[model samples]
Target: MESTEVLRISRLARIDLDQDEGARFADQLTKILAYFEKLQEVDTGGVSPASHPTDLVAPVRADRPDGWEAPRDLVARSDGHTDEFYRVPRVLE
Candidate 1:
């Protein structure tokens, strides 16, 4: 990676970089790109791509509907509540 390329990348990413910073990033990016290039040279003829490194299965719980009971005592305590619902002031006419 060249300093000019790094400057262009910084501009695209909306980042402000000084001349020294641009040069430093150029060197770092070049090393990282070189490492990726080196990785490309490895032979993986029989190796399969894996989502996870380990073969452990995740434990899943059975899904069942749990019945919900309303708080009838709370509604009874509220001044604005009727039998089961709480009444709010009308917002619009």
Candidate 2:
């Protein structure tokens, strides 16, 4: 990034940067972009995109018998309730 471009971006982002600060940011941005350019040269044709770098799986929980009285009691105490669902006022027209 050139100092001029950095200053323009800073102005657009409502950031105040003097000429020296803009030049410093330009140098840092140039190094960061160069690093990204280096990463672009890597071969990853066989690699699949992932949300995380590690392989993780959800833990399985053992099922136990539970009564339905809890939900019944909660609904009985609630201010709004129907036979199967709670009633809420329309929030949008």
Candidate 3:
């Protein structure tokens, strides 16, 4: 970028870039853009897409017997609140 353009970008973006910082960033950006330009010279032929590089096995979990309570019984065990909401102490200041 031209010096004026770089200065204008810094001001419009509300960023403070000293002379060295601005020049360094501009040079690095130019080099990265040039790298993208070089990538256009590649020829990729007959490559199958793959989600993973190796075979993966599924893990299993041990099942144990634990008596489950009904939802209505659980709600009834709370301190006098309906199933739709829980009762809590008033938090007013």
Candidate 4:
């Protein structure tokens, strides 16, 4: 965490750090590195990495065909309609 190293890192990261800010960040970076070093000493040989900590499963629903249809009155009110669908302008080329 030397001043020269801190200044170089700040420049590389596109940050403006004055002398006092650089000194403060140096001390904070030292502590953060120490914490990561401590974390490295932990035993996690049997633990598996996961997106979430818990073992979760998604619920499935039974699928059945429902004879649902749009009423003719609704279709008659539309600006454009085919036998099976409402038509609109193409959105993309």
Model 2 misplacement above 4 A: 44-93
Q: Where does model 4 exceed 4 Å of error?
A: 43-93
lDDT per residue (tens digit) for residues 53-86 in model 3: 7667667778876777776777778887777466
How close to the true structure is residue 70 of candidate 4, measured as C-alpha lDDT? 57
lDDT-superior candidate, 1 or 2:
1
Number of the top candidate by lDDT?
1
Query: Could you tell me every candidate's TM-score relative to the true structure?
Result: 0.43, 0.41, 0.33, 0.43
What TM-score does model 3 achieve against the real structure? 0.33
Q: Model 4 TM-score? A: 0.43
- Looking at model 1, residue 39 earns an lDDT score of 70
Error at 47, model 3, angstroms = 23
- List, residue by residue over 1-93, the lDDT tens digit for candidate 1: 988889888989999998788888999999999988987788988989899989999988889877667677778888798888888899999
Task: Report how far off residue 31 is in candidate 3 (Å).
Answer: 1.7
What's model 3's lDDT at 50?
A: 71
Sequence-dependent TM-score of model 2 = 0.41
